[model samples]
Target: MENAKSKIKLGIYGIGLLMMGVIGISSSLSTIGAKFPEASQTMIQNLISIPCIVIIPTTIVVGKLMQTISKKNIALAGIIIFLIGGSAPAFMTSFTTILVMRGILGVGIGICQVVSTAIVADNFSGVEQQKVQGTLQASQMAGAAIMVFAGGWLTEVRWNYVFFVHLLAIISLILVAVMVPNTKPEKMTTTGDVQKTKLTSATWGWVIFMFILFISVQVYSISLSFLVTEKNLGTAADSGLGLAFFAIGGIIMGLLYGSLAKRTKNCAIAVGCLMLAVAYVVIAFAGSMIVCHIGSILVGMAVSAALPGIFINTGMSVDGFSAGMAISVVTCAQNFGQFCCPYIINPISASISGGRSVNFMCFIIGAVVAAALTILMLVWGVKKNRQVI
Candidate 1:
């Protein structure tokens, strides 16, 4: 029993490490751009953008494969692929080849992202699941923080050295291989022996909600630096500090989620949305760096609370067989929403504000939408809990 518990703990750490794969290159974009001065800014930015695009489709495919393949094997494969693709850019001279490698890295991250969450759903339930999910998210935030700092430091030595951040996946590979069990996909069994694979209406509802929520919340991330600089409230470094506050807030919320879960219960999602609404309002009117950082923390806390709440709710709404696909669908919706946000929000903000304070306008718009979502979520939660009672 003690040995099994140790494996479970190590497996969680392995899953957490997998999240570091997607964000390894985020801080290296400027360094990479300086190396390839011939390439357009947009083309250079595609190093990050392209991976997000690839992850959308890759996640869907991995979701389907989970039903047939051993999840441990798939996770190991993903780690190997992640290590190769993420690190290969360090050696290559051609920009096109590096972009191709990033796409390959996306495939690996897609697999790891889906598998990590699905594994949590497969192994744990109720409060235990919520705690694990919270830790998983905390891991992602922590990993991203580590990679950003490490990548920045490495870039000082050599632009290419930044890519070495991915080599950390080797630790994940070892832990997962030794500690994670080779579990087959679970089937939803009934007394009649019929396998129920279809996700219910409620589960689909949460998926759609998560998609929309992502669209609204992501406005803060994409606009923060622009907003801070435009207002003359801070420099790029200060904006970076504000974002650090954001990560700190997320880590705090994630660690507290289990305790919060007991009190909030079904109302957790609504509370998170409501926090977001207030955060956007605070951010929109900020006249100083301190206020901006405060709002950033709120944004991070709100998302941390809301996203895990969604995952826990989704897991409870679906059966074991459907959980993998359900999570995949939600993950796809999230990425899709993030992809669409700039396109969707940019135009609206531009038109409404006549391009004046467009970034600030995004926060105002987000505030309004988040307020609406809070009410909607509250109603849904009340109804759902009533049905359970």
Candidate 2:
């Protein structure tokens, strides 16, 4: 049957979405200090954060280019670059060269980020589209978990071996080539009643909301190390364990996202934010690594559930042609939040806590702010649901 065949094709196409999340193999380098003892701490930190700088501009540029080029081609090109930049450093000893390669890797990730989301919007519609959106976020969280958890062990062999994890991008490249449809951007019609792609104020609202939401959510990872050291909770390995729990939470949340969304009448995001607020409160008062691990799991669940809602809402808020551009804007905002969480949260936390136990104070502040936002979001959801009824 044609319908049965279409379902098979959709299943294959979905695999491409999973590949987007795997390139995050870079996050597993927290233990680089053991391998690069000669480098200063600041320079070592740059090795991780510097790639984020290139990811933003490169994402926005690729979003614009999709109009004039094949989306499949752009994604394929990005994967090649990602593979080269991500894996080449494994063979080199120079810190400077590795950093350069990481920057290039960031560019490749930036391109894929935009293309991956756009690919979903292009292929599916309605509820099916939303399900795929959630799956994509789940895949990303799983990918990060895989890289960080596995990369941690691989680092025990040699830090350079961790860089080889980027080679996984090759699998994604093949999926994109064979599974994703090779089609040009949608052509605009010249006749009357052609739907002009105009993003409404609602679309912009989602973008700003995502920016602020990401700013709050990403703080957990940015502040984790300090939280561990200031509290004398445990070793770097313990912190790594906390991250693994976070990923597990995300995977669980992603699996239940569809059913939760239906039961909540689309208030799933509000509920997820409330959970994040509670998790932060728990972390603020955590006295043991066990407590912190619990908090990390909650943080992961909250982020995983909340992000897909934003992506699905953003997709629905715009036309197909504008979806790429709109989604790109929000994606840029999300990355920008990752880039700025430390600079923004550190001073605020220090001033609030008078520099003693800054991480705890930041968590407390994050909890209060997220709680307030949750109330507003819940109220909005109730009203919208009522109108639909």
Candidate 3:
């Protein structure tokens, strides 16, 4: 376990923090339908989900382009696009136009998100790599907490004010220009050192597993406002607090993720998934907003605990040259889940509760599915340990 330390600038490592801000940007917008009574429920949901929809293809394309384009340039380009797309909503009155802008914003998020991790894989190795990966998730969670918490207050003022959160991307752009090192894509070598990294069955397994995990997680993303409305918990601002609580959990777990890894080894992912399952169940049955906040915290911590492991394990699964592609594939699958979760779950939710709030149904189903997977992960860990013994 030789820990190869990377000499990449510290600030460059922080660039990934901005990507998490995207979550915060749209979290409060979950209540947009309330603001514009003319908008359909589907249209209201799209304002939040549209960025994720566009992120899928853009992430894949950027991952491939990383083979030829400089990571720094790609990141810079993403920031500019993000700034434009995030800010345009404030000026436009048309919902269609805003959706289009969100799509453009997704492009920036997709490109930068992939490149951020690729940069880490390219520069760092071993324990430092794991530490940085944890830091990346932690940063995103922290950013989400700040932005979501603030956006909640702003939402109370005016829904349009929430769009201003995208202004944070300008700061990220400046950091990239000043901090990220300029370099070309890694060249393939004839020495086999640069051999293309292919995704193993394990990689695909994890990718599919994450896709399912997110279907459950999106319940929170799309249903938080509704949860508040149906339950009489409070205002959309209060729902924003629920999202913030979720981010805070992630922030706490992400900061501790490296240490947690030291103790849990491969079991961390299993435990994290189980925690999420329980958290969703708690949310499903919550009697008060306080109880809902508890659930949000658990979900956040579970995500923070699980995702860094996935990112680190996936990045390490391949050679440095191919890590970008592998990570991108993993990211693409996750975003696809985010993009489609509402559509997939919403109808099922409608039927199960007869068009009442679907959060409870979605949470219940997510818990069952995640619980099953957690058992499998635990069993797999046990067998692997026995074989080693």
Candidate 4:
């Protein structure tokens, strides 16, 4: 407990939380606006997908940067760059250019996100490390939660102003680096450990888990903004409420999921991912605005519960270079989903809905993927008759 309360340690977790906020902010804005009202849902889906396309390779730089510099330095550079890239839209006139800027923003997010868990391990150890991870994740979720309100308030002022809110998190990053003490990275003991503990097929399973995991959660995020405009459900302000549900679902899961995992013998994760798949189906098929809203909460919960399972399991399975690389791979998958979903889902939903099927189709795909993965996993599990703890 004393370790958890360490002021220096909180600073480290603060960096991770702020990076998550930068990650969450982009999706919030993509969906919440009316300027793109005439765009097909397919176009929105493309919007999400496009940035992800850019992000996959950019993570190479994140890996290289972490190799040469302190993780704190890597994070600091990302925060500074994200602050600029994220805030750029407020002053820019063209939405097309805004898309370009978002891709740049993805680069920063991709790197920082890939390095987030490593930073915890880099700075803290044992129970302090675990506690810091929990808090950092909570902070990230809280950041997502607050972004809804942030988006609402900022969009109320000016849509572009939403970028400025990212600066607050950047400030948090600056504070953490300055306040936290610098320590040499733990020495790598053996090439043997690296070879022995590398990510295996099972580890890749979790990597896939994080990928679909983010999509399931982000489906609500990017969709919320557009769903409002499409359904003629209130104003842009209402969009934030959906994301609020997303964050709330995540927070609730993050808070209680560990206990749930303990009691259910980690059933929360298995159930959570399955719920994510179903939530996608619910979102895709939802007819009424209220139903969509309820679906959003479920999607959020699934995301929240499932992430811890993925993290804990993945962390146990992978180590050293393999861990770092796997972290990059999974995180890249997340941003890619965020980047791609807007592009893929938006247009599909807008189309199926008769005008902009992007939202509908995207969620359906997300749902389908989640469901498919779960079913295949179950088949594999049953065939092997294996039980996971």
Top of the candidates by TM-score: 3
lDDT of 2 at 48: 54
- Quantify all predictions' global Cα lDDT against the true fold: 0.77, 0.72, 0.78, 0.62
Tell me the tens digit of each residue's lDDT in model 3 across 186-266.
566877465565777777877887788787777777777777787888787888888899988988897788898877777
Candidate 4: regions farther than 4 A off: 1-5, 20-51, 122-132, 186-198, 213-216, 281-291, 342-358, 376-389
Candidate 3 least-lDDT 10 residues: 1-10
Best first by TM-score, ranked: 3, 2, 1, 4
Candidate 2: give its CA RMSD in angstroms: 3.3
Candidate 1 at 226: error in angstroms? 3.8
| Preferred candidate (TM-score higher): 2 or 4 | 2
Model 2: lDDT of residue 317: 85
Q: After TM-score superposition, what is the CA distance of residue 198 in candidate 3 from its true location, in Å?
A: 2.8
| Candidate 2 runs further than 4 Å off | 1-30, 33-48, 92-97, 190-197
Ranking by lDDT: 3, 1, 2, 4
Model 1 lDDT tens row, 1-389: 76775686577667676564554554455557778999864566567656667878988898889988988999899889888989998899899999899889888888888888888887777777888888777776666655655765676688788788888788888988999989786444656474756788978887788778977976765677568767988644465566666667777888888887778777778888998999999988999989988997887778778888887777667777788888888877776676666667767988999756988898888898899999998897788678878
TM-score per model over all chains: 0.86, 0.86, 0.92, 0.81
Worst 10 residues of 1 by lDDT: 20-29
Comparing 3 and 4 on TM-score, the stronger one: 3
lDDT of 4 by residue, 1-389 (tens): 45433765566556655555543443345443455776654454544455566667866567555655667677677777666666786688676787787677666666666667766655555444545555566656767767665776677666666666666666567666775555444435555332323567767786666666565566666665655566666455566666667667766766666565556544556677688887777766667667766777787677766665565555666665456666666666666656655555555555675554555566776776777666665565344334652
